[model samples]
Every structure is written in C-alpha cells, then in structure tokens.
Target: MATTAITRFAHEEIKPKIGSRILNSKEELLAGDLGPQIRELLEQSGVLVFPKIDFNDDEQIAFTKTLGTFAPEMQDGTNHKIHKITLDVKENPQSAEYLKGSLYWHIDGTMNDTPILASLLSCKVKATWGGNTGFCNTYAAYDALSDEQKAEYEKLRVIHSVWATVFYYEPEPSLAKIQGMQRIGENELPLVWNHKSGRKSLVLGCTAHRVLDVTPMRSAEILVGLREWATQEEFSYSHDWSVGDLVIWDNTGTMHRAEAYDPTCNRMMHRTKLQGEEPFE
Candidate 1:
C-alpha cells in the first residue's frame, strides 16, 4: 500500500486479500534498510513470494536474522541452520513423521509459550502432482465476521495441542503414539488474538482442539464452521511451487498447510523461522 522506490520492486495485491511478490534482486533484499520495509509489507500482505530467489542455507539464515531473531534447526545434528522439509525418511528420518501433521492447517509453535513470528521456505524439488501450499488470512477472515459472531467468538478460549493436528493425519493411533503426542502438552489461547497494532485475527486451525467451557458437540460445530469461513476461496491463496521459489509468511496472522501429495514425489523445501515477540494473549 505505501509507495516508494521499493514499490517498483514490490508487486502486491496479487490476490484479493493475501500475497505480494517481491521482484528485487538478492542484493536489494539484503540491504540494511530493507528489513523494516519488508516487515512492514509482511504485516500488510500476509504472504510474500520471491520467484527463483534460490537462497542457500547461509544466505537464508542471514536474511532471517535481518528480519528477526533466527530460529535454528535443532532436531538434526547438522551444523546448518536450515531444516529440510520432506517426506523422505532418508533425508529426515526422525522428523518426517511429525511433518505428516503439516497436511492439516496450523500455526507453527502453538505448543510453545510464544509462537514463531514467521517462516521462510524455499522450494528445492517440485512434486509431480500435488504439493501446493495454501495460506488463509485470519485477519481478513476476522474482519468479515458479523458483529454478533465477533462478540460471541471474542469471549472464547481455545485449548490447543500438537495432538490436535496429529489426529487429523492419524485418526486411530496406538496408545503409545497417542501418549507420545500428548507429552508435547497443550496451551489455552484466546480464540481471537488482539495484536499490539490493534488488529485482531482469528486463531482457528487444526492445532485448536476445542473451545473451553463449551459442550463437545458445540465446540466442534463452532470450530468447524469458523475454519470453513476463514478458509473460503476469497480469504485464501494456494501457491503452486516452482523450483527455486522462495516464500515467507507471517506465522502469527496466517494459517497454512500443504496440499496432499504422493509420498514418493520427492518434494523438498528448506525452512528457516523467525522467533516471535508476543505471546497468544
């Protein structure tokens, strides 16, 4: 929305409500002052796409540091900070099982005290059929709700757990597996997150288990209805991946998921995350 020299490089309003494509070169994106501008744009546009930016692990890490605190890859023992996202057990044996949970829409790190600020993902290998990533703008979704709906949802609190997402992928798991997922714990989050900027966004995603103090059937009905409303085509974007494409989205204000693909398709993405500054109050 704001115009400047960078406006020439910023091709925004890509969709009705969500994405902006940055046409700048790597040099411009790495410039000292561009970080704040990019962050500002990210707030206005929930998703930003860099076509064929092709940033390696170190370059991606450097870019992430410019935006906010860099969240390193802690699972694998590799020295590199970027985490490879793939379904291939050979590449990410230990973590691939957890990635299956990503098939359902979720806000990253909901189990943590503070959720992640943003996520930067670069496409490495493209899948043959499906692997498109979809993003829904919660801010826009919240703004579209009726006054009665807003007032009702505003007072609700949600119980979120990693198990909520995992169950979507595995409806019936062994008792041991269920217990393992529960160990990740749960947190009570406001159904609507009122940001410091005074903008509010709905926090409905697969990680959301249920509405606290509500009947089970009522909670399911509300959650299912909200998820459908928030993810309608008008408020969402589905990105078809191309090799070397890079995408970054505001994790706090958006919910995202990968479109189902064959496990053998060989799709891989390198990801880096920016640490969050606010809690889900």
Candidate 2:
C-alpha cells in the first residue's frame, strides 16, 4: 500500500490504506503555504484527522479557502460557508429529517454530476454515546478488486436517486415527503468512476437505486455485495469525535456513514466544502 508522504507536519498514518493524523499546531496550519502539500496528503490518505485543532467557523472557512475553492452552503437564499450538522429540529430544521439517511453508507452529492472535492467537519458538540463517523476508501477498495471483477464492473452503470435514500430511513413516507425527495432527482453514473487523476473508485452507495440493464435481484446482489467488500475493516476507518476535533475526507474517493447516536443529544458540527474540480465519469 502507498504511504502518505507529508513531511512538513509531524503526522502518523491511521491505517495502512485509509487515514492519516496530522500533529500540527492550529497556527502553523493556518499561517503556512501548505495548500499544495495538504492536498497531496489528502489524496494519499483519503481521510485526514486533525485532533482537537478547535477551529471556529471563521477559521474553518479561512482554512477551507486556503486548500481550494470554498463551496458556500446556499440555503433559503442565504449564502453561508459553514453548515450546521445536527439532527435537532430546532437547530437544523431544514436538514434534520434528511440527515437520517446519513446513517447508511453513502457518498454525498450523488445527484450532482460533480460532487464536492472534500468536506471539513469540526465537532462542536460531541455525542454522549456512539456517533463515530465511519469512512471507507473506495479508491483502495477498487484497486483491491480482482482483475476479472474490475473488468466486469467497468461495463456497468447505476441509477442513483435521492428518493431511494429517503426510503431507507423513512420506510413509509407521506406522498408529499416522497415528492420532495423525488424532485431532488436521480442521476445515471458509471459503476466505476474513471477520475481525471487516473485513479478509479466505486460509486456504490445508499443513493444507488439500481443497476442499469440488470435484473432487480442481480442489482441488489451487486450493490450490496460491493458495499460490503469496500467497507471491509482493512479499507475503513471509524473516527471517534472530541469537541474540538476536525476531519476532512476526499468525497470523490470515499463512502461514509454516521454511527448510531442518541437523537436528542444535540451533537453539532460545523462543516465547509471544497468545490469539485472534476465530474464523475
């Protein structure tokens, strides 16, 4: 397995194939011209953990821009770079219900042709129990597939829909709720994303509604089977959160899910995203 080559900051690999922990002071990270180095490290290690760096919203936004284009969270005509990650209706009324689907393994922005490059999530209120974010390196997973498996998968396509994700969390939903999710739409994407960087990653996730040109049973078998394979312990990492912890993961190369936690705990996180530079092909 390729190892992370980040020499500027004192760092340790979290796992052989997936994560890296950066041991650097918050000031150095913000003041230095480390964008290129950090980006390289991010690609090498799909997930980067900054233990208790404790960045507030302004600092997080500033840090996000240093790395790449900052994707502001545009909601209800309000443009804000920091998004509140929470399930509490009173705190995040707009996305509380939607976040329930986050419990399942999935990639974000599957409906969009180009998903965000990376997401920076800093914990503000840690969960009392559970709620460790789980991540799987899809790029590593794809590389480990047998040549025969890779060859066969390369020819397949998938239909991904937001409504499918809703159904996973809300088995029996009202027609109105279904209509809302349906309006977010579905996208047809290749089973294997042939990235510009010449690396391939599996696009399987909960949003993967069905495999095109395959029987329903076969599609289920393929999707579920691949998800299991990609998430094997060797290629996955589950991060335990602290109040000041911040994490960034390559959205284009990883599949992630939220571990179960108390709904009323009010675990909060502030997030910022980097705009995607390439489309999933």
Candidate 3:
C-alpha cells in the first residue's frame, strides 16, 4: 500500500477582517467532504490542520463527530457528548490552570484504556502572540529511532494517569469527568504501542509517569530520554493560529501541546473528543 499521504485545506474566510461569519456558520464546514486524500494524510501525518475554519462550538463539535466517536463512555449509561474539552476564562476558571499545562508538550486522553482516537480544538478567540499549537508524528518518531533502541523498547511499559493532572486541578474531580480522564481504563501504559499498521511509537510524555516493568529511577531516565529524542526539532511542526483555526491530532500516535500565550488576553477554544473503539495491540 502507498504510504505518506498529505492533504491540507485552507480558507481565506478566516482572516482578521472577515472571520466572525465563519464561526457562526459551522454546519457547512462540518458537513463538507474531507475526501479520502485527507484520511490517508491523517494516517500518515498523525496530525491535520484545517486552517481558518469559520466554525464555532456547535459547528466544531459537528466536525469532530465526523472524524470519530465520542471518547471515554461514562459509567452512568449516558454517553458523554464528543465535546469534552471546552475552555473559557469565563466558565471554567479552575480548569484554566491545568489547561495552562496544555501549553506544554503532550498527548490527549493518556489516562484512558483505549485513549481518545483524536481531539479537535477550535480557536474562538486568538491571542495576539505565541499561542500556536505544536504537533509531532509519533509514528514517524518511532520509525526514525535506532533499531537497537526500538528492540529494547518493545519490551517496556509505563504508567499513565489523568488523575496525576486532574487532581492537580480538581482534587475530587467529578465521577463522569474522571471516567473520561481514566479511559483505556488502566493504571499504566505500554512503552511501545504497536499500531494495527505495525508502526510503533514511544509512550513517553508528562502524563506517562514511569515504566511498569522497570525500576522507577530507570523508568524515569528511559522515558525522559525517549521523550527528548522523539520531540527533536526534526520530527515536529508548530502551527500559528488565526481566529477560527481548528486542529486535530491522533492521540494514538502523536503528542501535542499549546505554545505559551498571553492568557490575560482573550483565548477562547472549544474542544471535541473522539472515543476510541479498538485498542492498538
């Protein structure tokens, strides 16, 4: 099969002078056909950018559902809607702190058993400077590793928890909210997740605390070393946002983070999550 497909969609309707109209018109953008080319690119690139989308929370929520299912089913029998990661200076002040860490380099839903298949974030209010998102291809990162390292890593496992971060914000997070955080529903993560495609990526990041099969000290050293390696300048890209930008990354094989920005300035965003069905084995 052919590998490495790349497709990008952009619109001039999302510039400073004429962006507000698009956010109000989310259904059209959400319903547009993304075509097979974009799907293949998503598989190959681990990230996709829909720049200058004229989409709002309702519309962005609509678009994310088209990508995948709502992630992390709650225990209550009611499915949490796909729009789980909403951000606002007005509504969720306490959460805004933990979100500041979102500006760091990491992946989504590491705490879940299957994890989130993907996460889509839409910018409603853009900061004037330094609020771009950076994405890295974990599949590509693994492919670039030395053979010996890959061989050694194939046997390792690590512990990941949303509690580590959630408790950092709301010590007693809501049961449903905690369930979303704890999908994949495990106490740990394998250091190497072999995708159905057979590509493997390192599970090293801030949420990945330590190796399960190794000593804590050794695990820390290994995870940190590998994280530093994969995130090297060569394997990543940074995306600057204009108002109404929406970006999605595969949580299974990519790590993402927001760049620091003027938080005091308006920086509103609405995030939608995709529930994972199959586990990567």
Compared with the true structure, what per-residue lDDT tens digits does model 2 show for residues 109-184?
8999999999999999999999999999999999999999999999999999989888787788999988988999
lDDT of each: 0.88, 0.92, 0.65
Number of clashes in every candidate structure? 0, 0, 11
Cα distance off (Å), candidate 3, residue 188: 1.4
Best by TM-score: 2
Which pairs clash inside model 2?
none
Candidate ranking under TM-score, highest first, comes to 2, 1, 3
Off by over 4 Å in 1: 1-9, 76-80
Model 3 lDDT per residue over 117-164, tens place = 777777777877788877776777788878898888888777776545
TM-scores of the candidates are 0.94, 0.96, 0.75
Query: How much is 120 displaced in model 1, in angstroms?
Result: 0.2
Global local distance difference test of model 3 = 0.65
**Residue 222 in candidate 3, Cα distance off native in Å:** 1.0
Candidate 2 Cα errors over 4 Å, as ranges: 1-7
